[model samples]
Target: MLFVSTMFESHYIGRFAPSPSGELHFGSLIAALGSYLQARARRGIWRVRIEDIDPPREVPGAANAILRQLEHYGLHWDGDVLWQSQRHEAYREALAWLHEHNLSYYCTCTRARIQSVGGIYDGHCRRLHQHADNAAVRLRQQHPVVSFYDNLRGEIHADERLAREDFIIHRRDGLFAYNLAVVVDDHFQGITEIVRGADLIEPTVRQISLYQQFGWQTPDYVHLPLARNAQGDKLSKQNHAPALPEGDPRPVIIEALRFLHQPDIGAWQDLSVAELLRRAIDNWSLEHVAENPSFSNALR
Candidate 1:
């Protein structure tokens, strides 16, 4: 068990970072609720971050819509929302540091080439000394992470091929990769716990390796069960998941609680959002959440 010291509890910081590709959906609600409840339960800070690094994927007004939805659900966040687009300089500095320490290299490999030689990259450009003008920047996997532990899912082993591959930090198009940007931002926010979805479990080891490379502390991870659609696909913006209802968010919030397997509190249905959330935080228990992802009936 991961022991939480009193000092740590006093400084516990968690965040809900959603990519602004679309409006908040049922799955997004679950993630935001879990993180918010966890942070508020411990008297910690719950922050919101708009991951708008990829302009092509981001919806022009989705960030504002997401914030409005959070407010509608009474998920008030602490401090200003951190937009990834505004943190380019920080990512650049981190990338420069890695380059100076010989921890990163420029890769000229294309997607087709990587797919031709198995899906995982084989570090073809690790020793090529290629120029960065038109190439992507990849981190040299000096100390590959084989496995890591999750607070909810327990032990998780990394894929051998993925663990050893030289993953990209900066794309050839000059956009920062998710792994690089996430690690940098999490560390910048002094996040003590990461409460997210199980879909992101695969990247835990890679993030851990990055933490090791940068000599930063790895935050505790709690991957909540994902909410899958009737088609067995995880509900996501790319999957055309419907947006959260605009008006009274009571039903949606209750559904989220049920999804997390929290004890029934049907009588509290008439309470205000703040009161409902207060009761939820009081009775929140990680043990109640199922280890496996659950099918979401919100669409039905």
Candidate 2:
């Protein structure tokens, strides 16, 4: 379950962590290709992580299918893929440490209750001193990060109220929260930079806060523009975005390159997938990427 390699010893490490809720789609391809190029350009290790922590949302065989799609598009990874399902003990240990150090407390507040209080938790349980049965665990917000430096954007500030909230680390249903798992795994994998979609930009501060709590260094981040359909909805499984088709992936790769504003060396029609990828990696530039999400008719 643990992957150890000289790849971790590299100066830079980038990863594409996807939840296997559905088949790999165009939006995800854009993200994967962007991250892959960023890593390959710097001679850094690119890794893939299957975020299978949420079982209810996952399709049965989607993880293997995703790996196949990545390979089909020539987005080769550096090591064995990491599955969050195989890392429960690590989360348990982390939770234990937080609880023992009084850095986390239990909460029994339901969704409706939080919604009634303007949708932001007011640290109601932090004062009650009650560790109720089957309660969710929340980290105490001592050092809330209101802003973080993005590799592309100079300084992005987060909503002060949201940043100050004592966010959940584990759910009442016994599932580890995304922010906690991502921070822990990013550190575990020795990630130096995170290149993901712009939709996740809001959570960057929360993850950075976790790094501060753990006394660990935070990685650099670059959030790429989100691909949206005609109606302005982001291309995602919940919105029913179509999966990457089974065929020659050159054209789609070229489209993704254009989406990121990367230069095309030669005519893509005359190039193979491997060759196109080589050119893309050779010409990758983070400075060319857009700062905000975009609505594209091609994604429609």
Candidate 3:
């Protein structure tokens, strides 16, 4: 078992796990910057994890570009980066444990069938005990989590309707789902705190429940507001949010800091990355982050 030290638990360890579906955009930068500042303020370790397990949706050069973008923005991470694709064995081990405990079961339902019967996934496979020969796996949400606390947003809770739904852990195509992979990774990395965008708030409760099931300590969570577009839609790769400019990222970085409610240290148009980040770390504040799901489209 991955035991956390009392001292480390009291301190902080934040991460920004980004998918490699496209180059890092303004929204992605906001998340990274927020997580970076939080870690730096607490003198904690900041880590980056490449969620590249889904090869089918991953863009070829996006992963390298993301790393380059982080470097350009002066958001250096500690230790070697952890790639989810390279850790399939660990996921399998976790899955085997769940299977042995009878907490997971095979699911072979299709999307159309699911939609035809209300959108929630009913526990059709909970007692099937069908082997993994030709079935996906799902976590039986017997002890669903309805609420959890967020350090920034205060006591936030999940929709009980959503919480009780059994969710998929492994897909029909044999690929691991985000919920399962992320749980395993966080446990392995000993993440003490999670500082991510508010859009992910819905999944936090379920993840917490998973941690409880595995007898692991749940990390503190801070869900920062999401950056939206002019259309009031969240900026994302699917929404065609433009990638961060290729060279001289100072202007963009400074704007992102301001968006996070940090005071303008100085014009970063001419500053080196080291200078910019030093000022950022010194001025990071959780109070600066707004407690809402959306932010103005000022990054554009």
Give the alpha carbon lDDT tens digit for every residue of 188-281 in model 1.
8889999998788778778989989988888999888778899989899999999999988988999999999887776876899998989999
- Report every candidate's CA lDDT: 0.87, 0.87, 0.83
State the weakest 10-residue window (summed lDDT) of model 1.
1-10
Cα deviation of 192, candidate 1, in Å: 0.6
Each candidate's TM vs. the true structure? 0.93, 0.94, 0.92
Best by lDDT: 1
Ten-residue stretch with the least lDDT total in model 3? 291-300
Over 4 Å off, model 1 = 1-10, 291-300
Q: If both were scored by lDDT, which would come out higher, candidate 1 or candidate 2?
A: 1
Off by over 4 Å in 2: 1-10, 291-300
